[model samples]
Target: MDFKDYYVGLGVSPDADEKTIKKAYQKLAKKYHPDVNPGDKVAEEKFKEATEAYQAISDPEKRRKYDELRQDYQHWQKRGGRGDYNWDRWQTNPGRGGSGSQGHTMSPEDFAEMFGGAGRTGGFGGFGGEGYSDFFSTLFGGGGGQGRGFSGGSTVGRGRAGQDTEVDVQVSLEETFNGTTRLIRTGEKQIEAKIPKGVRTGSKVRLTGQGGPGIAGGPGGNLYLNITVSPHVHFVREGDDLRAKQPLDFYQAIFGGEVSVRTFDGEVLLKIPPRSQSGKKFRLKGKGMPNIERPDQRGDLFIELSIILPDDLSEQELSTLQELANKRG
Candidate 1:
């Protein structure tokens, strides 16, 4: 079997840290994800390759075992002057007389079973069981082997951690102002999610021990809730700041007066400057959204004034306006 270089596949060095490996995997997976490239066999294959590589190297124990196997293969290659060697017999623990665990020498039938007849639900990388290569299975057990920490019913090594899950939660602008509680339905279980004040779009809240059940009594996974803030009809958000449009009568805009302004807190009197025109903006400090990190602090609210002119004046009023215009002229 050909030697599989997992580090090279992930475009990372052998000593790369776990965070680097995860970032590289996420990048590659996003680019070649089967969901992103439907019906593209090449892309699908690449995704599987990256997933397989990540699975092999992400775990410290698995990576250590794989590194040992890889070193031995490289030594053999150096000694043999470049030629194919029998990889089927290269199990970590070989049985006496080539007869131990059937895993030592996976048969064609076993390989087919591992792939699950090319179905997409239960296989390597959970990509519908396309099956890992014979070389991979030979060194680190099959897809269901101790490698990748998925052993089905067969117990091999220590306990396996649970899988993380993500879900989307939408909140209104008002809900974000004062914080709110939401009920999340996962399968038959219902969970109440507490959203703190100042959470905006793309905010992530992680709930520990709420993911997939662990294997072999390991700790459960975590649940990540992604916040999606809905659009507001009256106001728009820019970071912690808020922007809104307020209407003003022609008399108030021209002569300057106190105007009632509506904010998240309550109605406040805003001083309108004399000769204020349409599109004039006013700042109200500490009247906008709260800061996520420091809830005590807040941002300023900007209100753009829109001047509206009165219409359908009575004859007497029109005459008075004309007399005033005459005097001004």
Candidate 2:
């Protein structure tokens, strides 16, 4: 197999950090994901190539080996020599037969981060054949007979499970209180997603078999919806509870009356006691956001009364207020 430049394939520098490499791969995966480009051979190949590059470098151990080999390849080329000698040397080296259990191997962390727990769900992870390249297998250990991947699975370079993906989804505050449905566009598919009630920011809605297409027809990965609840026009969220301001007229505060209060359910009449002060807080039991884990439970809504005085009070109204103050004194 020809030596592949994994860094060039993913458009990342050799010295890029794990976070940067992951970010670069995410963009490529989204663009060339097989699900997004069904039946397109070119796209499929590109997707596979990107996946290959990510696996090679996203892992520190694997990346270190690749980097070292890449330098050797570059240096060899500079000496007016092709990569044939490098390949021939490692392929014939008997000491290269370690099965990649130690140096230049894929780690559990690498598999989990890049392949969505590939270490736990081990499968083949190599180029067209030979599990990996001449350099990787030779340096890392594909040279062993009946070799097993570090993941404790069959030899690498076979079928691989698809990479998982995530999409940011925003919902209205009311939606969180009373569940909602959204038309989510993923890849080439438009999913009519029924968002459960009580999903807050950081909530994840997983869609099975919706991520990157499986390699060697293994299995499609999962897609996740990262929830972000939009701010409400009149309310702010606090845990499962909600808070809002309810405006009350000065007269209403002085002479107990019902005030219109907006809740997720609808507008309700909130009873105001006589002599209610501005900024007074009232709890409307079980009227807040729903508890995601506990379907049977809901939070309370707190309303702070804000007294609104007429901008231009009539003489009669001013005189009545003065008389009320005098009586109170």
Best by lDDT: 1
lDDT by residue (tens digit), candidate 1, 160-275: 44676788999999999999988877656678978889999998766766766666665556677899999999999999999999999878998999989989999999999899
Provide the TM-score for each candidate, comma-separated. 0.53, 0.52
What local lDDT score does residue 218 receive in model 2, on the 0 to 100 scale?
49
The global C-alpha lDDT for each of the candidates, from Candidate 1 onward, is 0.71, 0.70
Error of 2 at 264 (Å): 1.0
Model 2, range 267-317, lDDT digits (tens) per residue? 888999999999999999999888876656899999999999878898998
